[model samples]
Target: MTQTSNISRRRRTKQAKGGADYEAKRAELLRIAAELFKEQGFQSTRLLDIAQAAGLDRATVYYYVGSKEELFHETVEGVLDANIAVAQQLIEDDSLRAIERLKKIFVSLMISYEDNYPATFVYIQEQMHQVAADETAWAQDIMKKTRQFDQILIGFIGDAIAQGDLRGDIPVRLVENALFGMLNWTHRWFVPGKGMTGQQVAESFWSIFIGGMVPARADA
Candidate 1:
């Protein structure tokens, strides 16, 4: 290759490597920040704290992310997208019974919490309040996305009731809110070695749901 062509090739190669490295590093930084946010609330976390947790200096972090606020938003969005994407997939599975899909949604989320810090989800949910109190349109967008999952879940519960599984007397919206209330509080007490696996905890809790909603045996 001519000298100018050689220079162009070298520049392209360098840019490609830099882009790949940035992606990898960005993921690492987000992981550390997420865990830290879970350990401490978003307001309590600092940029330096994230850098130290990620084993990087402040300058490197700033090079990748403009500010802690930006990083927090990215991290929260990452967790929210990952979580709902999975639930959406399950909700859309036509082959699975709606009730089973419902159970799977709970089980899958418990696994996510078991793997990712439970606070990742709590962070996004708690942001709903902060954004709402500020009267920002951003909260409306967030809620719009959030209600997608709620609508899907409400449909699932309604299907179960229609199938004579859940009680018809109970409102679908009420059951939906109550189920989330249980899941949302898991962050407060769920821990890795607390004498139960994530799946076990999910199954146990889901059993309560099943018992309460499912019709009692005619003989009993």
Candidate 2:
């Protein structure tokens, strides 16, 4: 079965057993797991470590979070799904001009990364660039959703070019990849609650990159 189905089953099972308290504890465990994964790479982190950090025995940790992979999924998948959902909503919002939509997408995404705080960065560092084989259901699912997100950005850029909001000379995919590179590279240095907020970062990037993408003035 798919990762979604598997997760659903786990949720149902958890609910059947422990209801709201179970979910609350599981959420806390996932929080601890994300912090561990961020500090130490996934390969080095163990289920036992997460269990210990959560004040639970190994056996009970299994009852709450299952495996390390499941814990990883619990940490990452919600962020991915949320970003994708917001991007889709922005793309469908015809009320805004294409440039406005794209700007909102960039800003919103950066804020999301901030809000998620290291989960998105962990995913970028660990799995964003990997070729998703038929290895695991969650991996495949993440890859698929990631591509959909990419396409949405590309499509929006293409629309901007067609609408004369952006320069038509550059290839759409090139612009898309460049935008992603600019945003994704933040994983290397962006520290939450430090200098420049996510919106500031996004606005700075937009000014630098989108400035180049827009058509030059006739006076110039």
Candidate 3:
């Protein structure tokens, strides 16, 4: 190979390694931030805390992320968006019955929470309404997606009621709220290594919830 070509090849290799390192460090920083946010919360966790946990100084941390708010945003938003998308898609799937879709959503979400770990729990713990009130664009967007996710569940529940799958006497919004209570409350007590996995917890919750929702058939 020509000397010039050899130098170009080496330069490209160096750039690739540099990019990989940057991404790897940023990912480490995000993992640390998520753990801290889950433990200390958004207001209490500082950039310095994440930096120290990641073994990066404050200024160095900024090279990977913009600020504490941005870091928190980074830690939570992707998983939240992915969950919303999955729920939306599951509800839209014509092949699945309403109850099936809803079950998939609940189970998928629990698996996601466990898969993402502290990050999803951190988002669960955040008061997005208060965060949106501050008028931060990212916060407002998160709030918007949260509402969209809720509406998806509500709509699915309404359909199920109309189809005679779920109990019709109970209000749709109430059912939706009850489901949210079961799923979102996992943040408080659902540790991954505890006897059951996320899917197992989800299945147990589904069984209990569905028993109430499914109306009993008329006796002869």
By TM-score rank, best first, the candidates go 2, 3, 1
| Worst ten in a row by lDDT for model 3 | 6-15
Task: Count clashes in each candidate, considering only residues at least 3 apart in sequence or on different chains.
Answer: 0, 0, 0
Predicted model with the maximum lDDT? 2
Q: Write down the lDDT that model 2 would get.
A: 0.82
The CA root-mean-square deviation of candidate 3, after full C-alpha superposition on the true structure, stands at 7.0
Error of 2 at 18 (Å): 6.6
Off by over 4 Å in 3: 1-18
Q: After superposition, how far is residue 54 of candidate 2 from its true place, in Å?
A: 1.1
Q: Give the TM-score of candidate 2.
A: 0.88
Model 2, backbone clash pairs (residues 3+ apart or across chains), number: 0
Which residue segments of model 1 deviate by more than 4 Å?
Answer: 1-20, 118-128, 134-138, 217-220
lDDT score, candidate 1: 0.73
**What clash count does candidate 1 reach?**
0
Pairs of residues clashing in candidate 3: none
